[model samples]
Target chain A: MGSSSAPWKQLLLSSIEANSHLKHHSYFQLATVSSNNRPSNRTVVFRGFQDDGDKILINTDTRTRKINDLKHCPFTEICWYFMESWEQFRISGVVDVIDGTTPDPLKLEQREKSWFASSLRSRVQYVGASPGLPAVASEQSSQSPSLDPSIGPVAAFCLLLFDPHQVDYLNLKSNERLVFTSIASDSGKKLWTSQKVNP
Target chain B: MGSSSAPWKQLLLSSIEANSHLKHHSYFQLATVSSNNRPSNRTVVFRGFQDDGDKILINTDTRTRKINDLKHCPFTEICWYFMESWEQFRISGVVDVIDGTTPDPLKLEQREKSWFASSLRSRVQYVGASPGLPAVASEQSSQSPSLDPSIGPVAAFCLLLFDPHQVDYLNLKSNERLVFTSIASDSGKKLWTSQKVNP
Candidate 1:
């Protein structure tokens, strides 16, 4: 319950680094609500961070159903469980979409550099039809648009710029449990104010 | 891509069974949208099934925010990732809360049996203050209501009776990823209409 004293962001970054060093191959479960109000979740790999590490960056194809979900409702949440430390981090907030049509030069530059640096296999996902589309009957990721070396990043490649208003960090790494919330302050400076929460 | 031939229900049951035999600590990430339309998620153990394996069952304390979220929206979603098999299942639907106020005699009986069958350590969670409430500054799961043996089933224990209308099952264990959608028909017979979809 003394989670307030701990630097929440620093702890989170260290947890991620530790998990990666342990070869956890971990992923976060990203949740979004549909226009009809139903909740949907899927696994997403952590790509990077933005906005002074206040925003999380995740890649997706523009044509996916999740992209549509975000369009309808910007409020989303992500949950990450650190296997090595038995810790869990939950972030809830809104997102800004960065795509080919994005106006910001800095974001556009980041996208270009990241795209060129990614492996060709990873870029294949951006080559074909959007994720939720009709597929021909066959074996092997029939609808993954296929892995073709000739494929390059298409206009569908986009990034989700998550702006978190609340962060719930829970650690059960010991006999005791610690739960805390880092919320955006009313000060409007986007500073995170951390407090102890009941575990 | 040949997911069309296999019966939807059969495949799901087999996948669950396979995970159990493989000693996979498989859990589902349950998501519920708050009144403000923000989606939140946490991990829940795959407890059991109701409605003859159609409706999924999960246990929780009445004081959790998720219960309030369900009361506000009723619509929820769960994502289960099978580690060894590299398969994922997403279920989205409404939920029926089973507690002292439930009208169904069968469900009440099920809750009583499940509670008594659970271990003392598990039952201790039901003894605590509402999940979001402040806790006494102390050690060991502070407001986890304490680990006193005298604690019994308080008014907090409840069952989440999930009525899934959409089931999206994907298998990435092999080179080919199989994506299938099983939607409940409008005929009211609970018949699942299955189809192959783009992965």
Candidate 2:
């Protein structure tokens, strides 16, 4: 089965697997366009893949600059760098927000837990509260009340998903460099096109 | 007289130099938009920087896929990864072809040499030429065409100059992450706006 696959497909699968395996350790720099046409990029944790690899998911507090940028402009691009190998992978796609719901309760739970853990610090950082303040400190002492009924509903935030239709892969070897591109149609079939450029 | 500067200005100057220096290495990635409204990104060499310190130049041949994408769209984003320190810098701006007769000779020379020196191996790799040839000779013969003229110009052969308006810096530490943004105006004034975000 593996041998039957095209070279581009094989390379893509390997690269994606390598990237996803390094999800926890990888820092993804995501760029989103604002309504004013300016682009904004930030470092985000790679939450995981979804829709059978058709979509990539990331978790972030809804209050962050990225979320605001996404709201203004749904088009975004993401870059993942593997320093050890001097390899880089870039994904550009449309951003769609998804709330926790049916068809994947376990996935929803996992995402929620991750969000909670990640947001514990965000709550303090955004409000200018001292890091020394306890998580359960008084509402005034804390940036915002964690248990605020009014904010809780809006707080269960998740960056729905961004699906890349085009991806570029670059590998820098000691003396040679390789570049390839994969473009997928809406039906999910991918057309692989590649060229080597002067490095 | 231009040597001494205030602490803040000095810091800015040093950062710009450091950032430009990092791009001189073997690999870097740039994000551009496609006609289909999707984002396209690929790795390109860090050709060099301009004397103004306001723009960065990258080399590309006329036959590359990215050039085709750019012909359809000019808005682009770029991400630079510093291998040793795990530091990343991202910029979003408009990409324009630099005219050879522009006022700055230093910038022109740097870019010209970058394009002129792109390897023959890179050209073969860019065109997907290796796969069509026999396996045995492909590996060995790939190195023999270091001087072929066909390797010089790909579709993406023009020099890409990024006129940046904003830059985001991310530094990963053992326990904490630092994130900040700096914006430059037309008047050559740069203002830094920072925020400590949760890792």
Expressed as tens digits, the lDDT of each residue in A44-128 for candidate 2 is 6665566445567776655556666677777777776664456666666788764444257665664555455554544333333
The residue ranges of model 2 lying beyond 4 angstroms of the native Cα positions read: A1-25, A51-54, A72-75, A99-113, A116-156, A164-166, A174-199, B1-27, B68-73, B81-87, B99-110, B116-144, B148-156, B170-199
Model 1, residue B109: distance off in Å is 1.0
Model 1 gets an lDDT of 0.71
lDDT of 2 by residue, B1-199 (tens): 2322212233334545655544334455677655655455556666545554656677665545666667676767677655445555666667766434446776566555655666655544444433222234355456544445643344334577776655554454332333334556587565555444433
| CAPRI quality band, candidate 2 | incorrect
Q: Write the per-residue lDDT of candidate 1 for residues A64-144, one digit (tens) a residue.
A: 788889999998988887766777788787888778998999988777766775677678768754454555555233555
lDDT of 1 by residue, B29-107 (tens): 8999887778989877666666456777788888788888999989888887766567777888789888877888898
User: Which candidate number maximizes DockQ?
Assistant: 1
TM-scores, each model vs. reference: 0.85, 0.61
The iRMS of the candidates, in order, is 2.2, 8.0
Q: Each candidate's root-mean-square deviation in Å? A: 4.4, 7.5
